[model samples]
Target: MNGIDITVSTRLIQGLTNLSLGHVIMILVGGVLIYLAIAKEYEPVLLLPIGIGAILANIPVTGMTEPDGVFGILYNIGIKNELFPLLIFIGVGAMCDFGPLLERPYTVLLGAAAQFGIFGTLMLATLMGFKINDAAAIGIIGSADGPTSIYVAAALAPDLLAPIAVAAYSYMSLVPIIQPPIIKALTTEAERAVPMPYTNNQPVSKWLKIVFPIVVTLVCGLIAPLSAPLIGMLMLGNLLREAGVVPRLSNTAQNELINIVTLFLGLTIGSTMTAGKFLQWETLGILGMGLVAFALDTVAGLSFGKALSILTRGKVNPLIGACGISAFPMSARVISRLGLEANPNNFLIMHAMASNTAGQIGSVMAGGAILALLAR
Candidate 1:
């Protein structure tokens, strides 16, 4: 005590001593996230790291998120600069097989229809008293794409980032549970039993595959210049994968690059979940609107599918429409399962996948549209 000041209430020595009710609640929230990842096996890759980050950030004096700290460095490098989501999109494009969407071009309509959720939720948010930009950020959760939600929120409503990210990723993880009941309630048993066989198993030519990504990038960029960052990165990754000239780069993008970005992104996003920011009326509103957006996406998709089925005189399975919500393989598999349950031999995976992938593209484009409008 002769040479140094010793304060009993200093944060460094007061971890548990300074624990408040808010900190306790945040700790439990972090535990719940970890439990969901481990026990329920829900989005384990992202959730586990985010859960740990949440605990670390909420600790009284860890300084993990201080300006010079690890979390802060990660946030500035990744989330604040808007690099992580684009990086993840590269991986997504690398892993994507667009042949299905190419084969069934009409399914693009389902993808387009599903995007109504984004706009619908935006309007609702405005009515609920959110600022226009914040509403735009919150509504993008309807895209059902975590990266897109993050990208848009980072630009339009950085303050709402934590709740929006949590809501978007959580709903994406629960796609299997949330989609089925809504699908069942929307479709007739007979509609579910209808078969839409996929006879096109032909491989796309290497030249067409190479050209596709380039064409898509140009078209999306021309139509929505604001979307170029997101869409251009996505198509660049796909082009690398399909060009047959950069297998090494494509492989790196899909695996190591994506994985590293994911880890840092999760931790940085979780840092924003400190109790003071997360437990607010706005957070609740975002969570609620996020659910509404998801439901509307599903309903809209199913409605479009039903109409297509009627137009085609039962040759098309209405269930495939429900796959057009950007949930990718999960939504595709759900529709396929429902088809099989209705008729043991009813094979609809290819059909559903066609729409699912298109929905992915549609979501990117929708995010671009929102960005474009907000820019003006």
Candidate 2:
């Protein structure tokens, strides 16, 4: 009976014995993520699962990170071959409404301009002694698009995936907090007050919506064959949304598919944040540089918006340029709110949505461009 008691006690203490300072720190980090999600309402869907995964990963003897374990299996099947991010893109594309973008074609330029941060940060990362591949992956965090960041990092710098993903999603949630001050500092009151015309009178044709995806896929694939998987899947989702006859398919892609994929992807990514990998000077550098990348993207977009406002003789609201980050409705909403705050008559939501959607495509293009240039 005493032997049995001792054996049970030893087994119970095994986890405590193996726990390290690093594990404690990581667990606390996980708790912080959870707090942020629940209390701050910062991307609860994504962060909650991630936080739970991180806590589970730190616990000793769970066997969850083993070769055939859940994390390992998810990592191999979804992340290793770049399947999950691509799947998520399909859902994102389905959720995107390209009508505004089609109506205001010039906003695509804002999206393109926003992508300058990815390259700018890449050069800086290389100068900071990151390998070309790692720098490229790290630079992609500037895309401000989580799936793009994940897709690029998974391909180029799997080791840095956890930090990159966390930075990407965290900053995305903080768009309202991070972008406003920059937008205010960059533009004058007159610029922010500038009102642009929005015409819902001329609805984009159904045919155009359906055709845009196909043409984009064809052109983008040809220009960057390496991006075919990324762009193709995205366009496919958009096509499903636009097809009009496939509501079931589109709804499934938008809701069920995306939700499931996000859960698994976030958790799997969190599981990778083992203390051995996460607690390092390099991890700190990646986090800092990611903020730099995000700021650069916003700055570039605003600068271009200012230029466009100048060239167009105030016909374009420079404030809309801030929407060119790929945080979707959030960035658009931020720009719209800022516009309203500056000038109540200024209704910039549609215009901002145009730029926001353009940013989405631009981010994917930027990722494809990186893959094309460096993944070889």
Best by lDDT: 2
Tell me each candidate's TM-score.
Answer: 0.96, 0.97
Residues 19-51, candidate 1: write the lDDT tens digits.
888888887888898999899988877887888
Give the deviation of candidate 1 from the true structure as CA RMSD.
1.6
Taking all chains together, the TM-score of candidate 1 against the true structure is 0.96
- Highest TM-score: give the candidate number: 2
Residue-by-residue lDDT tens digits, candidate 2, 93-119: 999999999998899889989888899
Question: What lDDT score goes with residue 360 in model 2?
Answer: 92
Sequence-dependent TM-score of model 2: 0.97
Instruction: After superposing candidate 2 on the true structure, give the runs of residues whose Cα lies further than 4 Å from its correct spot.
Output: 1-9
**Worst 10-residue lDDT window, candidate 2:** 193-202
Off by over 4 Å in 1: 2-5, 8-12
* Model 1 poorest ten-residue lDDT run: 2-11
Indicate the residue-level lDDT of 309 in model 2. Answer: 91
Per-structure clash totals for the candidates: 0, 0
Instruction: Report clash pairs, candidate 2.
Output: none
